[model samples]
Target: MKKTILIVEDEDILREIVKDYLLNGGYEVLEAADGNEALSLFEEHEVHLVILDIMLPEVDGWSVCRRIRKSSNVPIIMLTARSDEDDTLLGFELGADDYVTKPYSPQILLARVKRLIESRYSTKHRKAAEDALASCGIDVHFPSRTVRLDGEMIRLTHTEFEILTYLMQNPGIIITREQLIMKVWGYEFTGDDRTVNSHIRNLRHKLGMKANLIVTVIRSGYKFEAKR
Candidate 1:
């Protein structure tokens, strides 16, 4: 079956360009010229992924992403004209799976789409295994990227949840910060440890005092410890 991708972009030329590439790549393409239309299409279709533009006529991408996150965990790749780091971070916070700057190569964008789709499926399979092991108390659905604690839902950013899941899977063993950067972010050369710290702070805050479940390894890094 062809995977469906919804492109919520206002640029008619750019939208058609992307739609064509996706169609050639064997994906079903759905295009929306505004946020309202995007939402309508979303509600009416089983979209496998979304490529959302930050600027729109009615609601803008951030607002659109916020509304979408309220009901769905569908993979989103945000498109931005600016190269601002803060914008990318905000998109990540709003559950975007990836971000692409404007004037990007169509081939590169297509590659990114293929990569994210594969990752989504692979993560789904891994989560099934993790769910079996984490069956009762805390359920972490990797593909859908939702977490449930004691049957109550918790909101977490992509990196935060990814880091938490990695630690949980390797409980009792000391996993270094570098290892975490590579594992959680899928890349190690971003040249900022602050990203890791920021995610940890947010994760701990979300987990509350049970933050103790993640232990700092003094000089080495950190590890996950199940509370007794």
Candidate 2:
């Protein structure tokens, strides 16, 4: 079955270009000129992934991302013209799976879409594992993808959940940022180490007192300490 992708961009030419590339890449493509329409289409369609632009009419991409995230973990790759680090960070913070700066290769964008869709479907079986990790009042249920700290349910984004899962799956072993990116975000991700750091920071903050479980190994990477 061909995966469906929603392309939300205000620019007509760019949207058509992306749609063309995605079509050529064997995807079912949907187009929206603004965030409002994007949200409408997202709600109405069974979209496998989203390619969203930051600047839009009626509603901005950030709001759209947030709205979609409230109900779905569908992969979202943000498109932005801004080169600022803050912009990229904000996108991740809003639960975006990835981001691409403007003037990007359409082929690269299509690759990202393919990777994200594949990753999403590939992990569906993970929720059926029925295995779990529990220690020091922090409990993670792999099947349910739920976390609890001292009996209190903790909310975590998809990225955060994956990072915590990978860390706990290999306790006491130092996992490099590169490894985390490859395992959690897939190989096509072009973001740097700071991207992993940002997600780790958010994950740790949510873990609160249990945050120490994720230990930073200077000059190397991070480790999930089984005890400390």
Candidate 3:
């Protein structure tokens, strides 16, 4: 799919020039003569990036940038005729990804657009791959009290979950059954090691092929070990 760039410039010739360069670069271009049109177009389409001019009628570029930042993290490059430092600073504070002064080469602007879009997409894809790998082995989310094994969700009872969470937290250290009951069921409980044994059996069953991650010590109890 082609990436879309919204060009919000009030100047007719500049807009046409930038749009031509972007189009030739194999990107889909959207033209907005002013800030109001820019906002409207942004709301209507899937705009991957924005090229905004600071001077406009109805609304200024800064206001447009502020409004876009409230909803989207889409890359934005602000264009201005003035090379004022304050304007550049304000654009950055408003979340503009890049800034270009007037008379910039159309080819240079296109290069900036390509870099910003590539950067945003690369970061998104990297994060996605990391998230997927997070579930590849035994993955636990403590806040949600959920566990995933080999990319599949495993349902566990409250006690079973607590037992698994504990072993996982202390991987490579064998935990005695008495210690497990004391921690999971609390010190006040009177249950024996059989109680811990029952929960472990069911937890291992739910874990399927990954059950070897929980290794049993001969005279002691069990510990979690990551697959080599």
TM-score of each: 0.79, 0.85, 0.56
Residue-level lDDT of model 2, residues 112-213, one tens digit each, is 787776755655553344467887788988655678999998877667888888888888999988888888877666667778888888888989988898
| lDDT (Cα, tens digit) per residue for candidate 3, span 1-228 | 899999999999989999999999999999999999999999999999999999999999999999997777677888999877667767755666567888788987887787766644544333333332232287875544457876676755445666787887787899988787666644343334544566677678888888888888988989988666
lDDT of each: 0.79, 0.86, 0.77
Q: Which candidate is the best by lDDT?
A: 2
With candidate 2 superimposed using the best TM-score fit, by how many Å does residue 187's alpha carbon deviate from the native? Answer: 3.3
Ordered by lDDT, highest first, the candidates read: 2, 1, 3
Worst 10 residues of 1 by lDDT: 185-194
- lDDT for position 81 in model 2: 95
Task: Note the clash tally of each candidate.
Answer: 0, 0, 0
Query: What does the lDDT come to for candidate 1?
Result: 0.79
> Which parts of model 1 are misplaced by more than 4 Å?
123-131, 141-146, 155-161, 174-209, 215-222
Model 3 residue runs over 4 Å out of place are 123-228
Which one wins on TM-score? 2
- Writing each residue's lDDT as its tens digit, candidate 1 over 180-207 gives 8767545324335544665677688778
